[model samples]
Target: MKKVALIASVAMVFSLSLNAWTLGKLGDFKFEKVNDNVYVMHGPVMMPNKENGGFMNNPALIESKNGLIVIDPGGNYNVGKNVLAEVEKVSKKPVIAIFNTHKHGDHWFANKNFQEKYPNVKIYALAYMIEQAKDNAAETWYGILGSLTGNLEGTKPFAFPNSSVDHKETVVVDGQTFIMRHPAAGHTDTDILIEHVNSKTLFLGDNLMKNRFGAFDESSSIFGNIQILENVIAKKDGYKDYKLYVPGHGPSGKLHETLDPFLNYMKIIIAGAQKAYKNGMESYEIKEEVYNNLKDYHKWDDIEGQMGKHLMKAYSEVEMRDF
Candidate 1:
């Protein structure tokens, strides 16, 4: 009798500890149900040196009558698992679709996990993203950088999208309409925008970030990104007063309100690049010259290094092309 009582007490303590662990970890995946059927999963902060926090960015979950739709599954499979666990707690509906914002690992690395779990669900992305991932399968500078920085353990092979949209496509599911618009080359060659018509929410992906400057690297075009922003702003009515804009890397906020700062930053970068290009400045020279001017901006601390890298790449790409 004494031995049985001791074992029972140990098991009870172990069970309580497990429950405490689950509750303690719940904060990491906290989500806000924005409306009747929509829940926005906020991305955690990216720890500068931590492997798991390298590319932490906002991913959204939309629960509709038809099923659940997830946007831009976080940076890796682990992050995706956390997100999935949280999602399951909120709704038992299977993930019917996953819309990848771009080809960046942060946005689409967990796509295969989603496929594995929800075998019947469709995975969607821009045709260009699929092509780029296939074309650059063996040579990804970002993947290499992540590995070096210890952001990732090693390159994990990905499963490309089976279905993709080249142009604007509308998908109606569960009494809600999602408009998927593939914008002209910004952030990446195949960036996509998702508009939840009923919720008046627009997931801008990396095209328009709230506080951070949108990155324009070798895969992106500065002029093109600016034009895309303009187009998004111009189509104000099309979005039904787009109240919430889900950025790929920051908190979701109002669309029109967040446009000015991003536009200003892009304009400044483009102007500086054009001037340097006309002056026949090399990429390194351009980087050195414009670094200070950009660093002086209000949110410079958040974007300086990343923007500097992007500007240099954009300069090289522009120099190699017309003009």
Candidate 2:
């Protein structure tokens, strides 16, 4: 009787612990219902660090009739555990599926926990994303996220996507319809923008951000991002006019407030790069000019840090087109 009582006591403690969980100084995070059955936990906008524990991107959820569908779980194992704990608060149903946005660890590394807990959960991502995850990207991001988060506990990459999704692919899970939209190369070559068709919500992934400036690495194309954003705003390519836009990082909002600002920022960067290219100036030479044009985004997170690289990338793309 004592042994059985002790087990019950331990279970009670574990449940209470999860309920009272706090992530660093960020406090308790719960999934805020954005639309009908759709919830989003907007994580910290700052760079990964010990304080933030590498939790930076927006992890979202869609509650269908029988189970839940998660988008971009989070950074690492423990973060994934915490995410699921928060998930339990919203719905007791099992997470039947997950969709990774791109190849970024911060967005998908948490697959470890989900795969561990729910062995049969079908994790989905772009084919390129799955390839990168199996290749060196997983280990590479492990080191990066570990160092950034000060090697926070259980920050390993044990699991990656098990299923591959493609552009315009319709995935119906538990009565919810998810439409995958692919760009040639936006935030990254592996980027996948998910459209939850029923609620009219489009998950822009890192292809769009609210008020934050993200890095455009070698695999990313400024021109590609601009074209995709233009098409989305114009509702081309059989895309629906979405009622809600959820960025990979930052808050979710309507078109003008969420996506337009970043689209305009991209335009300004490319235009500045164009002016520099026409004048026989280098990418670095146009930094100040582009920065000046981005006055509205000056206060955005990581602008000062990412502006130079963004200008360089935009200039390189412009030069390639001219030649």
Candidate 1 per-residue C-alpha lDDT over 1-323 given as tens digits, one digit per residue, 9 for 90 to 100:
99999999999767644543132332345457865566777654332234444445677888877588888776666556666766776678888988888877777776767777888777788887888877883247346436634644433666567678766688776677888777667777878888888888888887876555544556677777778778777874244457677777656666666666666777776666777788887656776656666654555334755666666766765676764
Candidate 2 residues 43-142, lDDT tens each?
Answer: 8877788887888899999999999999999998778888888898887999999999999888988888888889999999999889987897788778
The candidate 1 region of ten consecutive residues with least summed lDDT is 19-28
lDDT of 2: 0.87
RMSD of each: 6.0, 4.6
Return the top candidate by lDDT.
Answer: 2
Colliding pairs, model 2: none
> Could you tally the backbone clashes for each prediction?
1, 0
The local distance difference test score of each candidate is 0.68, 0.87
lDDT of 2 at 170: 95
